[model samples]
Target chain A: MQRLDPLYPTCPIRNVIDRMSDKWSLLILSTLNQNGIMRYKELNSAIPDISQKMLSSTLKRLEADKLINRKMYPEIPPRVEYSLTNTGQKLMPAVGMMVDWALEYFDEITK
Target chain B: MQRLDPLYPTCPIRNVIDRMSDKWSLLILSTLNQNGIMRYKELNSAIPDISQKMLSSTLKRLEADKLINRKMYPEIPPRVEYSLTNTGQKLMPAVGMMVDWALEYFDEITK
Candidate 1:
């Protein structure tokens, strides 16, 4: 059996939280949740000000995490669409909780 | 008034979430919550496997954020105790929600 680290002690779960809570990751998930599946260009347009490199890297990371699905089409410009996997959908409630918390406490923190 | 970026667009909030969700930050917050206030050495001992450098850096960052209050008493030996500020206490509910979500969905994600 694997030894589980104590909650307050060092553990791998910390890394997981860090990855999931990344600015790009949360925003990407939020966009996908709202818009269903979207093409790469469309996604880029949807999230203004994100550099092309950062957006691509963020998408790649999410896909590697199995949270999002990337479908590619053999078209002239190589059409691609990104959507949430079952695991990604499962994360909705958790992300929603964060967003709600943020909205509720934004004033307190920002002040 | 400053121009607020769209939620879906790139914004500074992402950076904030990233910092708060860092493994060390969460675990430190959890420890502080359970222990009320703790000296630096006590905190280090409480969290096993955390390197001295990482622990020190994490504490500094939290203090800079105004989330954790660091009190240094004037004595023969330097003694410092860390506690939560009102802002930090307010963050409890948000952090709790994340922990609850992790616990509830751990099986699903890990499986």
Candidate 2:
């Protein structure tokens, strides 16, 4: 049997799973996956319903986790763009599986 | 592209994902998977950190979602036990993938 404590907050796996399971993280990752590299305004537009505060924080967390890359231009305007890092890109397949599962059971579960 | 809206509040897939992504649902589901059939008290003991309200509500949601089987037996006192439904069983592989990914990257992400 695996050693990590099942569902315990103290588990290291919980570090990733808990963060990933946050309200906006999966949505943000899914958005970035579909839209590719995008500027802050573009991402904000893409996910219009997210509060600016929430979006900014979620982006920071994803960046901190190294799941997404943030590029800052030294231009006077200081353009910032976001895209999935290699690790984040690789994570898409698993997210895709979850999405597929969601799609399959969406009606039954939600109804 | 999937017709489901990408990360929108109006989307049905969001209905499933958002609910599943709730703070306690994954933990509860994972516990059930690890422990097999368990009574309400057993579940409560297994995840000692979860509040009674949160655990009960999460269980109801999982049961309603058809991801868990809730069995009730009537004797002098009622006995209720919970286990994974077939659909929930199918979901384990995707969850396993995520757990694997988390295990591999936990150090980098958490550090």
Candidate 3:
């Protein structure tokens, strides 16, 4: 594969595309969108195939990107939950549309 | 990165996302979308940073996915052209919105 173009830094849309295209990000995003708030274990369980390491790192990346919220509570053992931020929530409809389009064309695409 | 799950075969949107996430495809599609029809050389020139091999393979993948059309004209030297198919065109407004969304969020996302 060609290395990322130097234009990456200057091109914002391409930057967004790169992030959204991270493979795991969309799956994790879609899961949170469908299930609302979830604990770390819940997110891990939602996608059984993802490795714990991948889940942890992707979660961090999403949190850093500010697409998802990672909230902590001070309780007996302490509680942490994950959910979409407002930006992440707003992004869902577009993602939903893309999912619809993908679903509609899946058979055609994979064959 | 984690190896893709066995679930990949069963997950259609994931598959769609995988294809779309190929790094070069979106850039190439956007180029074709804006410029209408492009010859191989034009496409190569349009994205100055891409290696020629990468462009050729991505074009083939797009054509195989039916997201773009590849046509050849017979002549002394022969000519080939590429453009989006109906499905690709349908997908681009979503991509455009994604670009807009990315542009809107770039400052926050990258820094």
Each model's fraction of native contacts: 0.11, 0.47, 0.53
Model 1, residue B61: what's the lDDT?
81
Flag the better candidate by lDDT, 2 or 3: 3
Q: Give candidate 2 regions above 4 Å deviation.
A: A1-10, B1-10
> On residues A1-111, what C-alpha lDDT tens digit does candidate 1 reach at each position?
122334532333453565565557878988899899999999999877788999999998878767789999999989999999887886776667666656654554444
> Per-residue lDDT tens digits of candidate 3, residues B1-108?
122236767677778787887678888999999999999999999888889999998898889889999999997699999999998988887777777777777777
- Model 3 reaches what TM-score against the true structure? 0.89
Scored by lDDT, the top model is 3
Candidate 2 residues A26-49, lDDT tens each?
Answer: 888989999999999999888787
Docking class of 3: acceptable
lDDT of all predictions: 0.73, 0.81, 0.83
Off by over 4 Å in 3: A1-5, A74-78, B1-5
Regions of model 1 farther than 4 Å from truth? A1-12, A21-23, A107-111, B1-12, B21-23, B48-50, B104-111
Which candidate do you rate higher for DockQ, 2 or 3? 3
Ranking by TM-score: 3, 2, 1
Q: Which candidate is the best by DockQ?
A: 3
* Residue B44 displacement (Å), model 1: 2.0
